[model samples]
Target: MDKPEKGNPADVQMSDPGKKSGKQPVTACLICAAFFGALGSSFIYGYNLSVVNAPALYIKAFYNKTWTERYGQPIAAETTTLLWSITVSIFAIGGLLGALCVPIIIKVLGRKGTLLLNNIFAIIAALLLSLGETAKSFEMLIIGRLIIGVDSGIALSALPMYLGEITPRHIRGSIGQFNSILICLGVFTGQVLGLPELLGQESRWIHLFSFLAVPAVLQLCVLPFLPESPRYLLMERRDEAAAEKAFQRFLGKKDVSQELEEVHAEARAQDNLQAASVLQLLKSPAVRWQLITIIVVMACYQLCGLNAIWYYTNGILSEAGFASNIIPYITLSTGAIETLAAIISGLVIERIGRKPLLIFGFAAMAFFFSLLTVFLNIQDTVSWMPYLSYVCILAVIASFCSGPGGIPFVLTGELFEQSYRPAAFMIAGTVNWLSNFAVGLLFPFIQVS
Candidate 1:
């Protein structure tokens, strides 16, 4: 590992308190890039996670109806369960595939280009899913889920890289939280729209998937006007002038000489190393601990059981002794709490820093998860126990969003230099999607047992 040069602008800005006061303001272009980028990216991932929950029964019914028309017999219970599992789990499979593609895609397209291109998957997925009922093909819905998962897989990697590179280091963590915040917002939006008064009805469930197109279209319209990542330009393309212009737009400043010099110093430090492949990244001792940290954090991010909550909110509420009629409304609270907690985390992350928040969040989650288990086990004996169980669930959600929900993505970008970043995110995305697949596929069985 090469040490930063003495008085390197990047190192000075990071180490010196006085220099922090001179950090550039967050520009409108930067905000739009982060907002619209996430709108088209992680938002779709979160929406798809929860949207299917409200429409699960309807989608299953559609599956059965399609099977019966073709086979002259209704789908078997076992078969329906299997198909539903595939429908839910296949997203992770697609995500895994997308993660595998990230290194190549990001290298070729750059972060912004990759995000813009990813919207095609979202648009196509929306079409397949929204029109699945009209087409009388449940397979289309399954395929759509897979495609949108690819969109998420790519977005999760590319969006973070773009945001991390574009922002001044002073506000990087806060800007990175856009990914987590929009995801919560997406989950909340899905929950709100999935209500019976909206599109949750059997007749209207198709419209839930149609809503995927709105964010994709919004990003398509807005993101083109924004700049590509300055770090990517300067480090990879060696286009100093273009990188300077991008920094100016993102930082809302005319003089980006310090920023340019920082990237130049980093580029010189790397000695013109090419963007590394996943295999090369893994083989290098330089990033061993960084890679390990990413793997563990990302695995924990998915396997800590948040997706299980999002995927089966209704079922979890039912098990907590909530009435079937009230479960949907109760589920909405989880999304709301998650969004609120993530917003708060974004506000304080730079001040509080990442490690403390992560430790506190995970510790609080463990406590709440244990408490919720006790409350659920005794809910039948006491009227208030179920409400306590609900509170526990909300607490777990808050704990997660407070840190673990967002910081891993930020860390993935922070830990690696430009050469290793794409590969680093690819590895993180792989663990993330694989763990997501395990939860989506196995959680129902776990809950049953």
Candidate 2:
């Protein structure tokens, strides 16, 4: 085996070590700040996607009122469902574009700048969504969703890589888990703000669009102070000393040397791998296999029915036979559960191994999916049956997020050789968002099927 170069764990040779007075212990404040920043990024992703589903109640209200008056005809549930699903999945379509843009964004803007640049898309889309809803144009909502989708894709591709790089190895899992936790936070916050009768009314669907602006502005405003990922600094710019100083400065108390060496080693080693052109990423055995792994992992993670599980909460609530008025409150309960699970998962990411958590989470989800299928199929009609499905589904959601949803993200950051990291990560994101679109589009059909 080839030995790692000094200043590099083994992969990249460009890391610099600035002498430190002493490594401070990782403080709660620092951890919270890192976790919160990462959490905010992931929340942007989850909120942009899941929050829209709640507004379907209002969107459907608008469509029903409009088509009924204009056409003197009632829209079929199937037709309504199809159109709504399209509107929901439109973001996924935008994501494909955003994910594809990751390499150029990272290369030109650097990771932090690329992430901050997404504020334009978020604000513009949010404004459009509000105007469209007020004007009663489905087209405007579609446009807004498409723009939000692009922002979502950008976050999905870059945020995990950002958090993964800045985090200490010993606590990478927990910090990485912050990604999922924040995503859930987004979903939860959206529900809380949107669930009030005033917010959810047909007159206020535009409010949902406005909700997104808060984060977009927050990210843009504070981003000037945040550090760029050391991996990007070291690998792309070949500035090792600056990278080490950054690690010490930002991470502040984590023994960054071992972790720093690993990151440097990983980057440098992959830098030496056969650089494949676009064609070779698809054709070369090693490159192709890695690309395929990234794609398949992303696909499998979504198809496991976790995201659809949350995004369709209102639909799921109706199926579970809950009163319409009370669903969001209950949905918030699940959100709380998810947040607690994420906090625990973050702590365990280091103490427990990644693969074990992945396997356990997957197995638990498969079990819950099976349960949901059976209870829904039997039409069991028991008073508690739908509640059982709801709770089980929440459990599966928690487990999937705690493990697979969170794990694949960190794995993607760590998997690729330096040159292709951006490309490889982007491809995985493309696959994930594409899968998300498919799931959102198919959900209504799946509900009745």
Candidate 3:
């Protein structure tokens, strides 16, 4: 195909009066596609992250109640602690398992298919959680969390891949950042719903766990109407007609020839190439640097103590001298700050580039964590110390949202060519979940020590 002339219809269609060159204008279809895609996927991952935190005491009591009922004796504190740890950590373990399955699922089902099928995990998780209390089975809640973890794991990998495949090249970064926005929304929504007036109660706390299904059901209902990725249709399936239709629907315009041609050229270049597996990726020298970069960045994203702070924010705040009743409100405020920072980062990240935000975010987090430590140690001695600790924690949260929190998902799509991307996400997702599991499982022991 020849390039469109300067005044050609294709050229005119591609450029808006105020739009940047090579960038697609934001359309209603794109917004709906992105919102529904992330709503049931990455959003759930964020929701689940903070949801369990508010109901910790109630859930622990339920665990003990079920254990004692089953064994005809009161559950020991150590046993309850062990059981609770398993409950919290199993989600990440399940996430690791989900990440491991990405290559096969995406290859066989395609990106959209994988997401559609993945909704089953969410439904199952919700059912198990809603029934856990009624059945007097603590194991049900554990299993439900694990299933939701698997759902989240697949979403973390697949949603970004789908978003990347479907969006235009120039706007991809901004659109991709929307995943983090949805996750922020999910976390904030979870925190709000977990408040005492909602489902965060001694007797009604089970609703918080069951509410995971709402987004999944919405996604399941709406997904059939959205287009499958044009890139996936063209590159993987070699279905040009379908890919053209997909591009048209996604762009909300008829002239998708330029965009379609770009995807076609990329697909043609890799005509006979096969996707690399996880082991193959590690052993291949050609892509070793790319693989290592993703691994290191993903490790930093998870192991930077963000999850530890999030999972146990109340405890951290209590130690910082915040009263118990106000901790929920403070936790809600952090989510708002995170979402706002991510929005600002999305606006600027494309202009300033990813590396700078990442650097500033990580450096700022380190500085604030150190300050937080000092504040915690001397809060009783200094009248203004507790306020300093609050500022430090909020700053850490803001720094994370600005760069490290969302940049990695964007980078996974950017750093690798199409053929190597699945394998990269597979390895990176596994490392991320494993690191998360380590934090969730071991943080309690670390705190105890």
Candidate 4:
């Protein structure tokens, strides 16, 4: 690897770390870009995640209807279980494929271009799902889910990388958390939309799947107008002039010399190394801890049983003797708690630092889980025990969204420089989706067993 060109104006390193250039106000354009990009990508991911929960019964009914119409007989329970499991778990399989594709796709298309192209997956998924019932094909729903899973996998990797590169470092954690916040918002929106009076009806369930296209279309229209990442242009593509213009546009100011210099120094730091292949990345001593941190964080992300809790919270509520009709309202509260936690986390993350939040949040989750166990075990003995179980559930959601739920994505971007980030994300994303797949496929069986 050759040294970064040193004679350019971008090469002048600043002398004092504390004497940082004052940050310009975050511009409307930057917010719009991040917002729409997240809406099309992360929001769709959250929507798909919880939206399926609301319509599970309706969709299972449709599946039975389709199987009977096609085979001239009602579907057996065993086969129905298998088909539903496949439909849910295949999304993670597609996500794994998408994560594997990230390095090549981003390298070829650039960050903004890849996000624009990712919307194609969302659109195609919406179309397939919208038409699945009209065509009477449960297979179409399964295939559509697989496609959107790919879309989510790409977004999970791309959006954080894109957000980190574009935003100023001092505020990166705050803004990066917007990815998780939007995900909570998407889940809330999906839950509200999937209510009985809304789109979760037997005849209207297809529309719930189709609604994801609205944001995808909005992103497609608006994203092209936003600038590509300045760091990506300067560090990866070596386009100094273009990177300068992008920085100016992002900051809404002409004087981007200091920022450009910082970017140049980072690029020069990586000049000795080639872009790492997956095998080489795993073997490299220099990035060993960074890679381990990412893998561990992702493992915690799924294996913490947060998704499993979300999948069964309503069932838990019902078993605790809550009415079936109020489950949607209670589920809505979970999303609200998560959204509030994400908002508070965003506000304080920079001040508290990432490690403390991760430690505290995980610790809090364990405590809550313990309390939940006690409450669950004693619910029949105490009148207030069920309410305590409910509080424990909310506390778990709050603890999670405050740290473990969102920080891993932020960490994945922060741990690596430009050189190793894409590959690192690929590995982390594969871990994440595979873990999600495991939960989706096995949780019901685990509960039964």
Question: Pick by TM-score: which candidate is best?
Answer: 1
User: What are the per-model numbers of colliding residue pairs?
Assistant: 0, 15, 0, 0
Instruction: Put down candidate 1 lDDT per residue, 209-320, tens digits, no spaces.
Output: 9999999999999998899998889878878888989988988878878778788877887776877888988988777888888899999999999899999898888888
Q: Where is the poorest 10-residue window by lDDT in model 1? A: 2-11
Residue-wise C-alpha lDDT for candidate 3, range 1-449, written one tens digit per residue: 32311211222344442465444567888888888999999999999888888999999999878877788998898887788888989999999999989989999998988899999999999999889999988889999999999999999999999988787655777888888888888888888988988888998889997889999999999988888888888888889999999988888788878787767666665677688677866877766676777889899999999888778887888888888998898889888998999899888887878889999999999999999988888999987788899999889999999989888998887776677789988998999999999999999888767
CA displacement after TM-score superposition, residue 192 of candidate 1 (Å): 0.4
Alpha carbon lDDT of each predicted model: 0.89, 0.73, 0.85, 0.85
lDDT of 4 by residue, 1-449 (tens): 33322222222353332345334577887888779889998999888878887888888889999888888999998787778778878888888888999999999888998999999999999999899989888889999999999999999999998998888766778889989999889888888888888997887888999898998999999999899999889888889999998998887888888788788777776688677888877977777877888898898888888877665566568767677898888888988999999999999998899999999999999999899888888898887778888899999989999999789999988877677789999999999999999988887667655
Q: Candidate 1: lDDT over CA atoms?
A: 0.89
Off by more than 4 A, model 1: 1-23
- Quote the lDDT for 282 in model 1: 91
Cα lDDT over the full model 2: 0.73
* Model 2 TM-score, all chains together: 0.87
- Candidate RMSDs in Å, in order, are 2.0, 4.2, 4.5, 3.4
TM-score of each: 0.96, 0.87, 0.94, 0.94
